[model samples]
Target: MSSPTRVYVSRLAGLPVYAPNGDQVGKVRDVVAMLRQGTQPPRVLGLVVEAFARRRIFVPMTRVTSVDIGHVITTGLVNVRRFEQRTTEVLVLAEMLDRTVTVVDSETTAVVFDMAMEQWRTRDWVLSKVAVREGAKRFRRRGQSHVLDWAEVSGFAQVEEGQGATHILAAFESMRPADLAAVLHDLSSKRRNEIAAALNDERLADVLEELPEDDQVEILAGLDTERAADVLEEMSPDDAADLIAELPTDTAERLLTLMEPDEAEDVRRLLTYEERTAGGLMTSEPVILPADATVADALANVRNAELSPALAAMIYVVRPPLETPTGRFIGAGHIQRLLREPPSELVSAVLDTDLDGLRPDDSLQAVAKYLATYNLVSAPVLDDEGRLIGAVTVDDVLDHLLPEDWREPDKPEEDHHAS
Candidate 1:
């Protein structure tokens, strides 16, 4: 069956994208379009697909074979390179939704809510229709809604100052923090700041941790000092520390002072370590339980949704003071061993006490080798007094080991041909 010639872009968001052989590739996050001169409609370039590991990749329009209500099918060949927006390109859902434009006929201003792309020729798609609503006047419960030809709308070509991100946030409400960070990274600085400001503290913190340092610093700078401190409090202690280190010393101290005492202490402690050391990369808050904790208790601790898989993979056993810089470290218990043991069994019985713990001054290379040698996803770091201070996860190590620009999109390799 042939797919429809025209489809609303909003309906396409979140739809699963599949390969020709019926393999699911990813989900459609946004559509890429190139704006043309004057009133001509923008050419639909491709779809921004969130592939495995939350990597956003571009699926050129020519490679898409079908765009049905249930799913989008592709020609099986997908470029694995991360999608980096060109200056001439715009993301439809992210940049267009909720834009105020003048209705040519009425000369009245209306907010765009949705856009429709139509296939004008073989393999050629363009935005042809816009759905907008006029602002409701006093005494009116709702404003009038209209569907108009793309030509009837003005302001699509002009970048408006102080745009709101309500609709853009609504469209991507369900996206994970990492994916949302990518979306924000591709947007203009002003637009990105607007979206960041719209997000609640916790959501913004999660997204901030995933963004590059420059973006993180920029977004944090845009927020008021109090709000920035609150956002920092919501982030993982290690990540918050890393970000704070990037700011001017005075600015960093001010934010720390505004943060809750307990949270501020953790960040302060992390800042004392060298950047490429185990203490620098390890998270201050890992699942730490006393030796008396039962296997069931360990299981419960690892089940917390906020924990990354690597951190949850192992439970650190301590003598007392469950927080980081805890009392004498006893050992570590892998989640796998906990599951195999009787629920009533004490974690102490299954603890891997023989494993050596990392020190604050241990080099990143040393930490990586320790995990690789033991095939561990996470390992505990102990203080000079032999107390559990933190746990270094594999993900953190990889982040530092990769090139400084690892997060930024790279030029597609020769093998990943666009056609």
Candidate 2:
């Protein structure tokens, strides 16, 4: 027989699968690998086929007679049931691409952008090599490319069944939310949803807010209704409202009802605002307290790590009935002002009421000028009654200022270098 054909998983996917009699059987949907063997390289198990009737089934490697860049020929026998993986099996594209892994020989880390497979004999295929683009950030550098023998890659193949998500979470635990979202956007939809589902609500919310609007909607749509609502609640009201506005009316209404009442109310109020106004960009929750609150209270609020430095740099003071539609806006006090006073001193004593508070309908240009004129990162938004309503954060304003598609990466299509 001629030398066995070699191909990559990316090339194999979507190729038509044929039977021994020259009959078309199905198309390749994914390649499955058994990871029970030692970590150097896992055993190639089978092909997940999308056959007639739109059904998905598994054809064991033993039944695969030949595989080439253009086609796969099977033994004309395949199990027609839906492909359910045993604990030892993994779907290559779903679980592996964009995965951070280490090269054993060089001890360098890289992501698996594509994998090469070698057909050693009739019906015998094995993972042969990995094609990785070496760079810490995808957009920051057009990194060097390297092809390494499959044995040189260590981390991913060694992980046990059901551990892929765990490993992925640990790999990205230290990444900034924006960076994490960028990585997620580069992955296949299947891999993207898997990582998104594994993340906790707060972390997921932060990542969601950092993603572009379409990505934010896609991630939310992948989640179950209740879990999606919970994540929405974890997001700032303005962010949540922006996402909800992109969803269909019925889906948006259902998710809103599922959210906690107060959280839903905040998002609902934000949704009513025009997109370019202060009201549209401001967060309903800010570090606000009564004018009589002590300097110690302001310090405690600022010290909370969850608040962004911009929001934490100052505190808003209001009169009695300090709530959303709060009592009259008394003034704002910066953290520097708070620290100079005694812990027992009230915010009312040092508050600077001279600065102009933003109105909900203030133009984006007006809001920008206000922040620039005062050198403030966050400015309070007040109503006709002078009740404190929200705070426009600089980050939100920057989002508007940046070009559309600013969050998208500039890379060309993924590489297709098969062995």
Candidate 3:
């Protein structure tokens, strides 16, 4: 019975749950605990296990024989019903992780990344340590993690009652990511990190892209390395590169290592370009199709939900040998023009071949002027051989033209007083 004295909920999740006869049962999906009368550690209730066909079942801790890194042993009998959360229960992974609460001893706030439960006696458990991280807006990841005793925590009552991060974020679901980012900017750093952690990778990436560089770095630091990498993958390559470039060299390399090779390669290529150049402002993934593609094909590509409005606004038509560095850039096709043409008409028919594109090394000022002169929201960026490498959108160009801290809220004017 030499089970671990304490365990992190994340480590417990996915561990095999076995029956008394050593027959493998379901896997741990989440840990369940109930709020207590006071600050005393909440009681460990059981494990929410996912059995065959992804069916979730409740295995009370009363039946759990032992819990180790790889396995959770339980009494042979399991409640084979759909697992549901009781009003008094809290699902650690779903309800508590990444929450911001005050550390009593420190009198400052910290985010909960993991919770530790200690075995008080045989089959008896209590919430014990919390793996927390705390820092100001500018702090780095070098030395921010700390383990706070359960007694040192307060304000988690809101989390136990299910009125926490998830609830707060739901209110912003209707807002665009950029608008949400603006709202988050006005909140405290802890709140920003909490919401960022609660968001899905794609949504978080969109919001992060809309945030200031300093905020982006801070929020990314709050996430575990794996999660941060996943969020980076969801962002456009140019935006991802910009964030990574702002991070410390070591941190940047580590995150890049965690990203998928294909995604990492795209960001790396963008990173090689100067931030003020067209290459830096351009997104490699755009609505691109062969010159022979029909208006129907162009429309379908533009209609993809994944493409941002700017990216979907115009379609780049390429010559033969279609690839990343697409063969000789033939011309660009506007979405409006494509819609006006018959669905059977080839994209080449509506293509505007005379419009010149920016070279990778073109200056940001040149890019802005080109967009303005051409009345375009996005303009293509080409390589030496006139290959379409990417496209720069007006949003990207405006990001460069505005002050670095433009997303930051303006400070209130100081009150003038007679001396």
The lDDT of model 3 is 0.81
Please write out the lDDT profile of model 2 over residues 188-219, one tens digit for every residue: 56677778998999999999998888888888
By TM-score, is 1 or 2 better? 1
From the highest lDDT down, the ranking of the candidates is 1, 3, 2
Question: After superposition, which runs of candidate 2 have C-alpha atoms over 4 Å from their true positions?
Answer: 1-164, 412-419
**What is the clash count of model 1?**
0
Identify the leading candidate in terms of lDDT. 1
TM-score list, all predictions: 0.90, 0.63, 0.61
Candidate 2 vs candidate 3, TM-score winner: 2
Candidate 1 off by > 4 Å: 23-26, 36-40, 50-60, 76-88, 104-107, 121-124, 142-145, 412-418
TM-score of 3: 0.61
lDDT (tens digit, per residue) of candidate 3 on 170-240: 43456668766765665557656777887999999999998888899999999999999999999999999
- Tens digit per residue, CA lDDT, model 1, 1-419: 26898999988988999998999999999999998988888999999998887777889988988999889999998887777777788889988997999999878888988899999866699999999988765664466999999889899878788777777787788888988898788788988998999999999999998999999999999999999999999999999999999999999999999999999999999999999999999899999999889999999999999899999999999977888889999999999888999999999999999987999999999999999999999999999899999999999999999999887655655432255
Ten-residue stretch with the least lDDT total in model 3: 410-419
Worst 10 residues of 1 by lDDT: 410-419
Q: What lDDT does each candidate get?
A: 0.90, 0.79, 0.81
**Clashes (candidate 2):** 0
Clash pairs, candidate 3, are none
